[model samples]
Target: MQIYLPIAEMSVNLFLLVGLGGIVGVLSGMFGVGGGFLMTPLLFFIGIPPAIAVASEANQILGASTSGAIAHFKRRTVDVKMGLLLVLGGVVGSAFGVELFGILKNLGQLELIIKICYVFFLGIIGLLMFVESIRALRDIKKNKKRLKKRHHSWMQGLPLKMRFRASNLYISSIPALVIGFFVGILAAIMGVGGGFIMVPAMIYILGMPTKVVVGTSLFQIIFVTGTTTFLHASKNFSVDIVLATLLLIGGVVGAQIGTRLGLRLQSEQLRILLAILVLSMCFKIALELFVAPQEIYLLLRRI
Candidate 1:
């Protein structure tokens, strides 16, 4: 059966829509990402308008992240101190991003700009994660006894340093704030929970453990995406509740399954898989732009 998205002004297969959500929900649970970076692009390729895809995705992520975060919280992998700092920055960034999205929409550059941002960020982050994960795997395979060591980073010199017991590190609040802010902006513009960006940043830059970062990233995504959803609904009226609801029905269940499966895998394995997924999404979306147009979608507005 097909369902009409009032806001998107298109009909999509109900099963396909829910199935996409389920797939993304699994990734969200396993990787501690909201799966927006992946889902939004998929929606675009499937004939949804870029603006509608972005706004509706934010709504769906709110539901999916909430479900996934609960599982992480139960495991005690969340760093509250770090999460709070990220949230503080996210609020301000989300507000600014909503405005920017509206401005771009008016200028008729929303689709192009959104695709460019996705290609650029996904390529960089995915490549970095893939390389790092491969090295980590090699060390494990070689029976290398990796000592727990904290090396000095320039970010450590920043002011307002604080200790996070959960991740077993002391880092400056500045880095988290900056990362959170950037993630928030991406969340609003890209309809992502910023997990794709935040997860890697937490691991490499903030030096947070992978386990802790996943839960913390989810927590931060919930708040930032909530703000993004409200702003898009109020300002752009682009959110399709019907579409979000269908997606959430499958997403809520898939998340729990993902969390359980994730616990069985090594951190390096998780990172490598996520890296490949991100890269795959980037390439797929990039191809959409160069390919000749083969489908037509009509968008209607309420009079």
Candidate 2:
């Protein structure tokens, strides 16, 4: 069935949109990532304007993340204090990102910048996760002795330490704030929930336990993506509510299923799967960069 996207000024297959949403939603649930990274690119592949794709994907992410967050909260896994702190930074960062996005759009560099950012970040994060997960799996298979936890690190020495009872750690809020800030900027710019980066940062950089990382990341993603959605709607007028609704319908349900499946998988296995998915996306985007395009120039309607 065909559906019109008023904001995008185009028609698309309804089932295709829903199927894309479902696929991304499953990933969102499984990895606590918003799936926007995957969905936005698919939107581009489907011929949606990049701006429209990014903005609308943010709205869709809000719905998926909400569902995932609720599931995590019901399990009492979310870290409320940590999530709030991250949200605080995320809000500020998103504002900056939106402003930069506007400038890039006006200069006609927004799409290029988005693609480059995706390639760089995804490649780095994917490789790291893949290696780490493989090592973790190996250690598990060999029944290696657990190493002692290192309490002292550069982050621990930083000032303004705060306790995160749910995460069971006392660390400087500064690192958390910084992490959230960057993630928020990326979230707005890339139409992603920033979980792909946030999850690893929480695990490796902030020393957060794996159990709480997914839930906490989702909690922050909800507000971050919601803010981006509203900003895109108001500033760029690019958010397609109709498109978002269809995607959300499939995404929300997929997320629920994914979350349940995630619970059944081992942490190492989950990380490996997520790593592979990220790398695949990175490879696809990179290939597009090298391949020649069918259209060299395009017409744009006057604003």
lDDT of 1 by residue, 138-241 (tens): 98889786654343567767888788898888778888899999988998898988886787788778878777888999889999888889999999998999
Clash statistics: count for each candidate: 0, 0
* Residue 277, candidate 1: alpha-carbon lDDT: 83
**Which one is best on lDDT?**
2
Residue 218, model 2: lDDT of: 90
lDDT per model vs. reference: 0.84, 0.85
Ten consecutive residues with minimal summed lDDT in candidate 1?
294-303
Q: What TM-score does prediction 2 earn?
A: 0.88
Q: Candidate 2, clashing residue pairs?
A: none
Residue 79 error, candidate 1, Å:
2.7
